[model samples]
Target: MSAIKDDAKIAVSVVVHACGRIDLLDRCLDALVRQQFHPRRYDIIVVDDEPNHNTLHLVAGWRTRTLDRGPRLSYVANPGPGGPPAALNRGWRVARAPIVAFTRDDVVPEPGWLAAGLAACDDRTEVVCGRVQTLIAPHPADAQPGAHALEAADFTSASCFLRKPVLERLGGFDERFDIRGSDADMYFRLLEHGIAIAQAPVALALHPVGPAPWGQSLLRVRHEEFDALLYKKHPALYRQKVEPSPAWDNYVVAGVLLLALVSALLGMDIMAALAFGAWLLLTARRCAHSLRGAAHTPSHVAEMVVTSALLPLLTVFWRLAGAVRYRVRFA
Candidate 1:
């Protein structure tokens, strides 16, 4: 990758949509300041999706220690917690650069990131997605526990870069999605518009992936709901991106758990026992499959055992919530 020479105009704008993870955001900011690329080549625009001014003020506070003179950084707010797409839209409005790349507040880019990313975008490809691994020292095998790391693909996470022409061509991220799958949707749209999406495995970024969320919270419901909305937009395609064994296994376990609960309350002990046995059986298979890749510690095994019991339930609850919310009528 070519190093930034004598002061090129800031042709790239790195749009980061951040909320609530101040520590991780600070880490990204630190990495940005440490970037070897000339500050004039790119500008960092952070959109504070959170309502609190503290998130933006924190970025301002970092300048005291960061003392970054390279890229000009600015923070903006969205219209009433409109989520990632909304935040990015706000960021895009103020963007003066010809290229728009995306990253999460939790991502710490490597030194050659900006240079490599821009170079990858010059011709043929309109969407450039780089690699991201867990930020935690001994990172989890998967960014989300129980799942595996994303394979090198034609697409990456929301952390990819979009050329200005292509960004304008696709008309920006769809605001209909509050979050989730919106990144994938954008990539597919790029393809529809004949824009190539390529993977730059050498361009590494550290993602501060947190503990996987499990349970029946409103967030869980909303995530699934948004996914359903996404599927509605591209039914056949969603099946391709988010399908295969692990998901179907999850679907079956959900049915089994519901059966056990309802059957036990109806005082059908035999039926309840069978339902419970089915759930345990499915959980064992899932845990075994997920734990197969390496040597397991007590904590890992314990976590697997515990999460197995609830993961399926959480997944189903979310999907069902999504389907209902989006009025998804699956065949």
Candidate 2:
């Protein structure tokens, strides 16, 4: 790849959404300083969602220390501690470049990430989506790959480059997605508008899956609410791209448990035993396949196994709630 000329007109503004994880923000900012692209050719904007002044103070102090050779850095405070979508919209509003890139505080972009993303952009490209690879560190002692061990997603806000005009025309991210699914919603809108999205395989970002509480899966069950809304807004596209098959897994899991409970209540011991056995067998098989390379240690594997068993039940329950709230049957 050729080096970007000093006089080149292409400059990118990177917007990072940081919500109280100052350490991760520090690492992300430090990584940006090492990018192969010229420091003057790119700018970094960190949007802090923390309501308190601590995050702003931390960034202010860190900004003074980074004036030597790093890209220009700045921070924007959210109106309140809302969510990433709101923070992102605020950051991009003041962006001064033709290319507006998005990433998260927890993500660290590769040194060539910016260069590759810009190189992938042209008159025909409306959006440039980089690859996101999940880093699963099962144990503290294990060596982490500087790059991704496995690629997790083809596109995400974790790393992306979009033309400033298109973003402005679309009026930035939809705040309706207060927390999750906003990234997907943005892309769906762009596609609907006949915009051409390109892929930059070399523009990589590492997404580390941090350790979490056992109830984390239950919290994620809330995605069903967003899914219901997403489907309601764009039924054909959502069904075509997001979920081609019906939510049979949820129904099947719930059906087995319901059958078992009914049989037990009716004093049909043999039927109850068969229904319970079937549910266990199905859950075990699915868990084993899904956790193949994701779980690295015994503890990690155990956590995943237990979470998998509970996730389906939680999914069905929340799906019902979402259907009622949205007044649309997901099935």
Candidate 3:
């Protein structure tokens, strides 16, 4: 790429939705400072969802430091009670770029980030998305690639971008979803509105995913319930797109735990011992998977273990929250 081409490329803005985790946000911002894309081609906008004044000051400091270099950096505070979607919409409104990219405050984009997404765009494309890779210690030999192929979709929220026009039409992400399932919730709504979504393999972000926060699992289960709403809206597509989960696995886990509880109470030592051992083995594998690699201090290990134990509950809660919050608004 010529220096002039790099300097003249269309501007792209990254809208980050951040709350209390200033440390993670800092890392994300730090990565932006090092983007291989020309400094003139993009800007970073942060929406501090924290109600405190300190966040605003921090954002100001970042901008002041960045101004000495290139592309303008800006920050906006959400007017409503803080939530991810709400914060994102707030940032989207003031974005000055023809393309607006959505990324969590915790994601670090790859070097070719700007060129990758901009190259993927064309007059006919409405939205584009990149891949995400988890940052973990002793990373697995096999990991799922997050960069997805582009296609006509309802909507996309996972490390993605939208044309200014489509974003204006969809009114940004559905702010009603506080946490869980909000991405897919908006994605489904976008499909309903006839939006285009394409995936770019070259654009990528490194995002962290590990252990769950204490008892936050129920919200995840409740969140998944919104998937049913999609079914209600497009029965055939939902059926064709999503597969039936292995319900038998859950049943076995539940039954084994119940049997172990009954056996122990009845002093059936052999059966209780075997069932308890089986349960521990299964849980251990999950724990192992979650804790594999990067640097983990003793405290990190404790947190990861706790999160692993709590994730199943948290995921269930998340999906359930989705189902309850978006009860059959299908028209």
Q: Assess each prediction's global lDDT (C-alpha) against the native.
A: 0.70, 0.78, 0.66
**What C-alpha lDDT does candidate 1 achieve relative to the native structure?**
0.70
Off by over 4 Å in 2: 1-10, 138-152, 178-180, 210-212, 266-270, 287-305
- List, residue by residue over 249-281, the lDDT tens digit for candidate 2: 878987998899999999999999999999898
lDDT winner, 1 or 2: 2
When sorted by lDDT, best at the front, the candidate numbers are 2, 1, 3
lDDT top scorer: 2
TM-scores of the candidates in the order shown: 0.80, 0.83, 0.68
The candidate, 2 or 3, that scores higher on TM-score is 2
Candidate 1 per-residue C-alpha lDDT over 1-331 given as tens digits, one digit per residue, 9 for 90 to 100: 2233422477788888888778878888778767777766777888888757677788777654445465667778775647787788788777778788788786788988777887788677777888776544343532253222333344654457877777676677888775556666776677666767777777777666555533223234346556777777877667776652235666778888889999999999999999999898889997787677633877667666776677677777777777777788632
In model 1, which regions exceed 4 Å deviation?
A: 1-8, 61-68, 135-143, 146-153, 208-222, 244-246, 261-268, 287-306
Which stretches in model 3 have alpha-carbon errors above 4 Å? Answer: 1-10, 139-158, 178-180, 190-194, 209-222, 228-237, 242-331
Q: What is the lDDT of residue 150 in candidate 1?
A: 34
lDDT of model 2, residue 127: 95
